[model samples]
Target: GKNALLLACMRGDLVEVQRLLQSDKADELFFVDSSSQNTVFHFACKEGHTEVVKELLRDNRCSPASAGLFRVTPFSIACEAGHVDTVKVLMDDNRVSVDC
Candidate 1:
């Protein structure tokens, strides 16, 4: 159930995502959506949706963030997509590795 909701977020279905979020069934904003092969943050970063990314960060209910990072984290995706702002946000978190 949670995974499905996050998947909708990955596809940028903000409307459906908002609906799912409103349901309160998916309180975790950081849930990973494997369909895009990334976390919700990854999708927001890759798509250059700064507002969405900011919103997710503010939620505080997001996942602790993957440690393995699998090289698929928002920071990596942002770097790959050439979105500097996204990269900056993730990089700001010292816990997230960017040397790779």
Candidate 2:
């Protein structure tokens, strides 16, 4: 299921993340956990997986502003977890708003 993507991101598995991203599943990109509602991007950011975060963000389907459980955004989670590299990668995206 789409949960695979989230798990891969959480584990910082770049190879798996890349493999999954190549598949034709748009829904996977937006896949959210049942409890946390965290997307692949959210988990990747939270875990400080800079490469995974970069790969996820490169996907046009990835939503940098997407909010998860508790209305937490990927950027916010990254910052909260002190993922400096992840935050920097996200900030590099012009779509990310630090104000949020």
Candidate 3:
């Protein structure tokens, strides 16, 4: 329930991010911030943290998302940010709407 970790993620601080998620109890990774209306997954995708994305997906609790579900999804955010790798990662989830 700490926003600092998610903020670090939004800022793309991989080192701090990992430190915060050292335990990575799935709940930590799945924490969604109402302020940003984003999960850590959304931040990783928006910031193009492809490796983080993969790590997140490895967790069964990491929910599949299409556009932030509030405004933009990870895939849509990645595409908008022009991160091809991140977009590709999102594309791997057939349930996500690439057209969005």
Candidate 4:
């Protein structure tokens, strides 16, 4: 169930992501994929899904700076993946520290 959110983010499916976010299982926004320890936000950033990342960040509970395995934050993942727009989005968030 939560994996669906991660998958949606990975595929850059903004509509599906929005649908999932509005569902009762909104907590899935914070759910980290067990194998990767990456949250939906991380998946979105890594996939260069700027819209998906923006949608995820709209939720207050979605931590902009939450690190997954290897202490890799979404911002770092975005940069590593060459997601300039996603990086810009994350940089705009006050909770995301560039120093991290």
Candidate 5:
């Protein structure tokens, strides 16, 4: 399960993501990938996975602004990647800071 969640987010697998979220181990949602220090939110945001992003955001534990290996926030990545919808979803979250 090391990268299972990360992979699912990258592929935009909403169903698999939902199922994963229901598991007791769902807290792994914030597990940073070894290579990138990127969480599921990071991958989902960069790839423009709107549904996946929403699902990840539903969990209060997930942080939209979590930094990657070099301290790059998922919000910034989503903007750079042109994921308007994903960015919007993140922006709407009161937990995420647009200025950060």
Candidate 6:
């Protein structure tokens, strides 16, 4: 069920995501997808799941600045995808560098 957390983030299932985060497999949040090299935070931002994004941000393990393919950060991905709400949430996080 390692990938389940990623899928939950992709689907914006806040409840499932929350459950997974509390499980012993919570470390799954730090696993970058091998194919895309993107974190669960990236998927949440890309989908513009504002609540999901918020929940993920609550976890210190969730790296907001982690770059995926082509050096794309979750913030950059959100901006590129025109996910304004996601972008706003990232902006509010001190870990996310707006200057990037």
**Highest-lDDT candidate:** 6
lDDT of all predictions: 0.62, 0.85, 0.70, 0.85, 0.85, 0.89
TM-score of each: 0.62, 0.88, 0.72, 0.91, 0.89, 0.93
Report the lDDT tens digits of candidate 4 across residue range 1-100.
Answer: 5577888888999999889888888784568778778788888898999999998889877888888888988999989899898899888999898884
Q: List ranges where model 1 is wrong by over 4 Å.
A: 1-23, 28-30, 35-37, 67-70
Q: How accurate locally is residue 25 in candidate 1, as Cα lDDT from 0 to 100?
A: 69
Quantify how close model 6 is to the true structure by its C-alpha RMSD in Å: 1.5
List the lowest-lDDT window of 10 residues for candidate 4. Answer: 27-36
Over the stretch 1-100, how does candidate 1's per-residue lDDT look in tens digits?
Answer: 4475556655666666666666766665555554454666666677866556655665555532553245466666678888787677776765567777
Q: Write the per-residue lDDT of candidate 5 for residues 1-100, one digit (tens) a residue.
A: 5667888899999999988888888875568878888888888888999999999888887888678888888899999999898888888988887895
Residue by residue across 1-100, what tens digits does model 2's lDDT show?
5477888898999998888888887464567777888777888898999999888878888888888888999999999999998898888899888895
Across residues 1-100, which tens digit of lDDT does each residue of candidate 6 receive?
4488888899999999999999997894569988788898998999999999999999888899998998889999899899998898899999998876
Model 2 TM-score (2 dp): 0.88
List the candidate 5 regions with Cα displacement exceeding 4 Å.
none
Cα deviation in Å at residue 67, candidate 4? 0.8
Can you give the lDDT of residue 19 in candidate 6? 95
Report the CA-based lDDT of candidate 2 relative to the real structure: 0.85
Instruction: Point out where model 3 deviates above 4 Å.
Output: 1-8, 11-29, 66-69
Candidate 6: where are CA atoms >4 Å away?
A: none
Model 4: which residue pairs collide? none
Clashing residue pairs in candidate 2 are none
What is the Cα-based TM-score of model 1? 0.62
